[model samples]
Target: MKRKLIAMLMAGVTAVTLTACGGSGETSTEGSAANAEGDKNYKIAVLMSHQTNAFTTAVSSGAKDKGTELGVTVDILDGKQDPNTQASQIETCIAQGYDAVLVEPISADAIVPAVKAANEAEMPVMTIVQQMKNQEDMAVSYCGGDESKAGKMQMEKAMEAIGGKGNIVVLYGPMGSDAQLSRKAGYDEVLKNYPDVKIAFEDTANWTTEEALSKMETWIQTGTQIDAVVAQNDSMALGALKACEDAGKDIPCFGLDAVDDALAAIKAGRLAGTVSQDAYGQGAIGVENMVKYLNGEEIEPFNYTECIWIDQSNVDEYIDK
Candidate 1:
């Protein structure tokens, strides 16, 4: 039912409230593509990696809000986590003569040619969330969190929770994704300083709760002594937490992407902690920067928002603002 609702929202058939904006109660939907004046100054395309997840949905909302604020037309497109689909969308954007584009890349390598195509067409492209390979040479501006820093902070918090020594089961995102690789690098960097900390099991769950739950259940059945679970995203973290609860195990689980559920879990002492990337701000700022670029104003090459660690002690700061 939730997925059906999301699909409807994505299709611009209905409106939905966005999360990750605290409790300001601002509403946004995919249908709001025009400015308040009803005459758009520029037509921009906001291509998302996927619209199914809370993070990406909030991003889409942010882009829409910014577009409305700036009196421009912003069309939201879902990539469905496929590079080919995103490439095709870019081609469509080019053929339609979009004034600018904001891309949330799914694969760093696969997105290069598509971005290059946009460049050849003389269209401005800004990347949000995960960056593509050779980012400087491709996207004109970037607005998102530092994946490496987020991973480092998440691991450090988990390590601190587990007393710096334990067997951790790491839940990964898509195997070769930019977030997966860079976050793993950060985790490895942190593990280097703590020799007692070992990775007992690690695999990609594709950033989904169901897959993470299934994998964790199998790990439990195998009798692996998992001291903690570190998930790449909040959805997987919640799944891992559920699996542990079902198995009657008390495990400290950590995650990135401090979504609302994760924050509530932290408040209720179910989740250990998560890293905040300001998903909404990333989308809004990407559009804002793209507008600046289009208006012949100088903008920063890389615009990264703050990535902070959220735990029980500070979860209230992020919940229901």
Candidate 2:
């Protein structure tokens, strides 16, 4: 592990040294910024909150690929849905003296102090997909989907499937997570326009398929009239679909994060639709900019990526990719 971290730091620093001393478009943010920072090697540590789905795999792939393209070292850590684990990992990165760190925190609040510590130590920390709370002066930047917009898009499609007014079941992610909260806000905003639309059941599964399936099955057994399922992410939507299938019933389900399974479900006419946050781009671009900023370049504090809507009408164009 030590050898790998050394290699990453050296690789990144060597690349930056060349650009710092010779590049035309590049401007130094400080005097001898790359070299004078001591013989310390540059490295980027990425902490992912969880990796139970294809979305996180794609995100990790994108960041590592870009790191290789630019000769930077990328050290990745998995928090496994635990905020305490994530916070501990961030501290480890700081202790190791990494140049910069990237994080996909478990929630908006749990990972703040760890990030705050990194910033206090003068190591720049940034976030992807899941945002951090109280990120004013502590964290450096963010790159992810527009949570509210993604949620709004999913609810809109579900509403149409239910004929504008019906009882909708909402399967949210972990409570207090940035995506979970932001997307719910969007759902609330749109629901106001149609007063008759009601949220029949809303709960958090902590973002696991099994939990969602269990909750959905229990709901079905209760004989409650549910017109549609609106999930904050694709995993939950698929779980809801499984429950509906087991109960021998059909219900329209809308979800966010257009993973391969979601796309296939839509193609098979099982799901209503899903929103794509471009997991790959979120990781790739977030790290690319982090490297550039560390190399004395300017970058945006909040880099929200564009999202795409996918359904049966346009699922083919996105499935393979």
Stretches of candidate 2 off by over 4 Å are 1-41
- List per-prediction Cα lDDT, in the order shown: 0.82, 0.78
lDDT of 1 at 117: 95
Tell me the spans in candidate 1 whose CA falls farther than 4 Å from its real position.
1-40
Clashes in model 1: which pairs? none
The best candidate by lDDT is 1
Give the per-residue lDDT of model 1 (tens digit) for 1-321. Answer: 011122322333233333211112223333344433444577788888777678888777777767666666677877778889888889888888889888888898998998999999999999898888999988898899999999999998888888899799999998878899989888988999999988988999988999999999999898878899999999999999999999999999998988888888999999999998888788878887887888777899999888888888888878865
Model 1: how far residue 98 lies from native, Å: 0.5
- Alpha-carbon error at 93 in model 1, in Å? 0.3
lDDT, model 1: 0.82
Q: In model 1, how large is the Cα lDDT of residue 226?
A: 86
